[model samples]
Target: MDPHPPPPPQPPNNPVFPPQTPNGPTIALRPQMRPTSTLRPQTFAGSATLGMCRMKEWWLQVGLLGVPLLAVYLHIPPPQLSPALRSWKSSGSFFTYKDLNIFYRDSSGAVGSSDIVVLLHGFPTSSYDWSKIWEGLTQRFHRVIALDFLGFGFSDKPRPHGYSIFEQATIVEGLLRHLGLRHQRINLLSHDYGDTVAQELLHRYEHNKTGSILINSLCLSNGGIFPETHYPRSIQKLLKDGGLLSPIILRLMNFFFFSGGLGAVFGPYTQPSQAEYWDMWTAVQNNDGNLVMDSILQYINQRKKHRERWVGALMSTSVPLHLIYGPLDPVNPHPEFLQFYKKVLPMSTVSVLDDHISHYPQLEDPTGFLNAYLNFINSF
Candidate 1:
């Protein structure tokens, strides 16, 4: 496994508009401006028609004339990674709750008797990502559920619909109630985007009609906590804005992502380890704008910056909280942010793995990550 991380996203050097051909694609050069009160573009058709003449003609142009691109960013879909086997690596029962298909692996020891571990994966990866730690912890806990979040894993993906983090949280809550895992506080272990969905679930847990469970403890690794922290790379930023250069970039990504070779080029950008990370990276490469959707909700919707709200939720609960971080990944919340947690949370602990555990510590350093998890659960 190569230790060096992938190169950062190259600066977008293309012009906002392409050269227009007589019969080629339209080359409208419109600078993307997200709502601002700054000076407006000069209107050449002018005020001459506004007061002096009655305009009887109406003009409807293509999807991209001066028409402002009104977009509702949704969640990124996970790479459609094929399950290694229909049979479990470490097997469990199958169940469903309101459109989400869940696979529950029964724990081997007392960890299964009184408590449970519910794990979640973020964008591009499925519950399959948890197989490593799940294998290690399943024996000790009462039950270990690595659920396939809607639109991720082998779960369903509906078109033209939204994938908001809030929506995914609801589905997970319903699954818990449907599984009869209620009245017992459960430990939550989440990664990447999974961390956000977990926060929403815990915050809204009090109002849960089923009153199924409480977040006994929080174990987060490599999640997008603050947007400015893992701020969008140049490639991601340009694509989201639908710049004229977007279509080309999208096609380029599709080519590399769908290809088998060094498609893993961007894999280490998150937390470089082995080039194999790109295998999972390209799984959801075509998950229908799941990344863009996630970015919008995360960056634009205030969902991503809810660190205070998440910490506040932890404070409100008597549950013990712990953070197992991959210190090598600079973007994954620093120890300072943990101070905000300490300001309000008294029963919280922080551990950092200075190994190859970048964002996905579970995958990077499974042993250390699992130890931190089991220790936190035991503390409660």
Candidate 2:
């Protein structure tokens, strides 16, 4: 049997999206227009008996196939924002970016402080990933800011919008400008997809395409920066290959698939707790955010498209750069990847964790991660 099942029949002409919030800038959600419905109630009259027999067979097959999926779905509790997230939201602020409300946390109650660090989070998670280290950095730096890109985290997750790394870079720049950091020396910290965005920012900064902002130093964790060396997970490969049917498949199996995928990325020694999994799940499931996994995974493709520019940004940027890697990261692991980084930019400060940490070092080994980060920034 073909792995991809046929798409379900289209709904009758109806508004698919909820009405935009009254106070925010109007979102651009065009109605999903489909040709007229093919199955009218009267059309089935002649074939009622045949249809009924076929429907019975279909239901039997569906029931057998769906029992496990239904059980899995029903077993998982609906997600909720954790107390940490609730506290962060209370202290954080929001601003409109491209008609969507963007969420961010800033330590600088007063602007114009020269010392700054901007944290960019990786995929399938958000600024809340910084929760472990947010307080630690705030004490040492004059300003520390972290924002959820448009599609992820507390930021608005618009279904049809293009979630490109370039656009992500633009949003970060916009945040910098909004906070009056355009002309200031900004320290950068990133992991996973955030590493790609940092590379784009570095490229733009070197070319003078960005505003007056200056990157004094950068510390990027494990990510698919050198696309050639990166290996994506099985779920990622499936969604990329599944085409239009992927989103539908994702919606059906998000909780099961996401939880498993998260488990795989962590080092064997330090897996996430059940509560941590729920917190991450709640972030993605909010506003049907899991539906856009297909759109967001397109960043892997974009990484290949701009590999030369981003990789060259690493190869050539004058800003001091560091790579603090979770050596055992299954998704973007060491040996090959770290070797590639050292091969191209041998002099860039590099640290491989001894604790067998995985992709999310800040969560797995916050002290080690923060020490490496603080040392890197303070060195400059």
Per-model lDDT: 0.59, 0.84
Model 1 lDDT tens row, 207-278: 453543577777776666544455433344555566456545443454344343222322254443333454
* Model 2 Cα lDDT, one tens digit per residue, 245-296: 8877876766566888888888787888888888888888776778788889
The reply for model 1, stretches above 4 Å from the true place, is: 1-112, 206-212, 226-230, 236-252, 255-275, 278-308, 333-346
Q: What TM-score, to 2 decimals, does candidate 2 have?
A: 0.80
For candidate 1, the TM-score is: 0.63
lDDT of 2: 0.84
Instruction: Give the Cα error of residue 41 in candidate 2, in Å.
Output: 38
